[model samples]
Target: MAILKHIANKSADYGKVLDYMLFQHDDFTKKELLDDKGRKMLREEYYIDGMNCEAMLFDEECEMVNEQYHKNKRYDEIKSHHYILSFDPNDKEDHALTGEKAQALGLEFARNNFPGHQALVCTHTDGHNGSGNVHVHIVINSVRKLDVEKQDFMERECDSRAGFKHHLTNNYLRHLQQSVMDICQRENLYQVNLLSPAADKISEKEYWVNRQGQDKLNELNKQIEADGLTPSKTVFQTQKQSLREAIAEIASTATSLTDFQSGLLENYNISLIHKRGRYSYHLPDCEKNISERALGAHYGKDYLLQQFDKNTKGLEKENTQPEEPQKPISSSFPNEPDVSTIFNPSYDYGKDPIAILFVQTNLQLVVDLQNCVKAQQSEAYAQKVKISNLQQMAKTIAYVQEHEYGSQENLLESFEEVSAKLTDARKTLKETETSLRDINQQIHYTGQYLANKKVYIQMVKSKNKGKFRNEHSSEIALYEAAQKFLKAKNPDRQFPSIKDLKAEKEKLTIKRSAQKDTYNYFRDYQKELRTVCSNVDSILGISRIRQQEQEKSQDIS
Candidate 1:
């Protein structure tokens, strides 16, 4: 997924933005790092470029422009706009995304979007919190340097005029996000719909809070382990996460609004507030109530009502008893005995235990086929049909005994079990395949980094550094990207050997093979059970009517 984030800078210093993008910055202080000589330290790994400006002299040119236009004179005036386009970490592994390619895309994006601005387009491979996501930073001077024709995304007259400050509207942000999606699609990279609301809305602040809280919890757990005491809690959940979980749990089973409210209060001590036709939740110890909008669309009133209706229908279906089988009507044809009389002359089919079991189980093979309507028309045909039915009955009985299914319900239960297992097996297989692919990607990148290390080192040491870099730019970018990836994977700076990664890949391949076998086993078992159930239903002439009734009920619902 590629995410676009916008940050408006109010500081008049254009140099600080360029410094932050090009140099190593202190994590907590957000200040550039310096050497003993008091010179800013360039970042170890980054790809820097520019749109409508020199990359190295971005700050100087932007300041000259700002001074010429007298646009960012006041302390409160917006100096620049920073837009970060973060790509999915898997894009590198899955789509062959490199820093050079991302840098080129970033430059293109800046040129197309902020046309008349002195924009610095920088690409970084190392994401915060060791995410290893490749991202691009586009910092455009707030004041346009030149007058230009209006584009479809431009919203105002000043948008195409020089000396006017850049304006960001919600609509413009959406346009930029769409542009990122389009770029990702064109590059065959991993992309997600950035226009839709997230199912779980975690703000940037809340996300960092959760991360910090988890880190603190882990440290606490480490201390407890040092004292030989086991920690009771291993996972940390934010207040919103807890609220979301409570609401989701109750809503899944609640059949009505009252049930939903009461379930939350009784089970989690969370109070529900319905105001202005919207839902909100108040946690037991929280001072303020969190609205449904804060949680996600899934926790909203309309969505919850739909879930409740679905659950109610499911409950009704589960509780409803199966209808009794209807008795066969007698035929009015002359000199022809009806089905009931032909099957049994004196025995009462409605009252007989064996006859009732035959109907309930839908085992047509167990019934006397000689008394069938078609069989009774011919003596020779009746004998042949009886023989066939006897053979089928023996096979059915053997199958039932083999599976230890004493009744129809048992067979149905087995089928359900197999179906569930098959579903789980498929999910596991998919996850395993993903992991295997990740391992292969790791091996590939690790190999690339090792192979191109010498070339990058030579470029750094060469007398004519610019010429060397231009000649071997692709190799250097790949090396840097792979280096950043490996560093993120192993924060201790100990890169794993390619041999070890291949071994891990081999193990994953074996595990995937086993998972595939398990998936196939369940799939085959489910299919066989389904076939048997279908045959029984068809023979009893019950499936078609039952299906029609189900369809009718669905339509009514």
Candidate 2:
């Protein structure tokens, strides 16, 4: 059966979607090709010949469609619409269709469904990550001004009188699913009932998030295997799964909606946040709040209430039953301290760093200290780079301003310009700092990955391999993926030993330290710059206030 997923692009740049569909042959490297003009191009993919397309060139087709959309000044936030049509990877019947036939089918679906809209449809033999699923990408301009009619005999058995205010109407989506199912039936392909209620519906975003999470967890497990450590779920994974299961179980048994809410806090560390008529569940260890809708209909407010009513009715005589046994440890936060010890009480109102950055807080002081050190290190690197880049002439000019500019008695006129430059400088410095910090972060993760891989490799070579395989399958998968990536970049490259990995990490650390020192110097210079500019601004501000008063007096006289 074909699965359809919709993606709304707010960037309005259909060109990225075009690049994604046609030219992105590989994710890790840019796909370069010589166009008909013999010029090297990165974005353009030569549209395949004998493919059923309204236009021969993919880029030109998208541009033509989107250009017609710009005539309307109605600035909708959603700029482009992407529909992915995926067929079962194992189905030979689906596989038998040529790219041209698949493309033609996708085009017919798009043209009929999105009448009066410009669309680019392309058939692909594999999923983006090489998942081996045959799929078609239909990227359409949102504007609609033309009428479309369903194929005469293939017309939906439902009413045609109703007009749609939005493109994604429920009736239309149902119709589409039925239409696809019909095609599959006629073509004798494996089919799924798209119209049936999903057992547990997961949105596209959540699906990707879960997949990525699994990938990361698997990657970490690989390191554990290498380290010769007993592989298990990370502290984070254990907590998250524990919370989700606890909520589902608690919701299942609770006698009332209020009891369900209270029971969750009493038994588990989970907390519910209700805002704007939507419910979100949170836990101390959780990086982001998850909505009840995301959790599923079973945990939704209406379902909970309905269950509560049924439970209350069923338990008329046992209303005063004893509470179920809970774990000994306290679940919810009792109360926070008078002052946050991690951040200075005077600085930032002693805010919790966990709230600002979604790092594990249960590890407490060690994690907090590490974060502080990392931030300082990143800052120092940026400062050092700026200072090293400064010319001797600029340094001399800065020195002269520091020593003699204030005495000139005309610095106030330059205050605004200086302030503007200072603002721009700080912004640029921050961007540079972030870039350096990201590199350091990547290096840290890489070191961790390498360390774990070494340990895992040791186990894989011994009798312990089977035990490790059963325990850390995810980790092994991730390790294999990493190896493939490494090999792809350089087929001749061999996996480095633990010593080499550590040596590389140490070099990165040394570079970071030097950058930090330079960053510190530049930071000090920035502070000095701010001070000089602020002092002049203060004088100018006071003078302006006095002039405003003088103007009022002149107007009164």
Per-model RMSD to reference = 20.2, 26.1
Q: For residues 367-445, what per-residue lDDT tens digits would candidate 1 score against the true structure?
A: 3442354345446546655555544543454455444454566567778877887899999987887787677768878
Q: TM-score for every candidate vs. truth?
A: 0.58, 0.42
> Cα lDDT for residue 174, model 1?
88
Question: Clashing pairs in model 1?
Answer: none
Minimal lDDT window, size 10, model 2: 358-367
lDDT of model 1 at residue 220? 100
Candidate 2 positional error at 220, Å: 3.5
Model 1 poorest 10 in a row by lDDT = 352-361
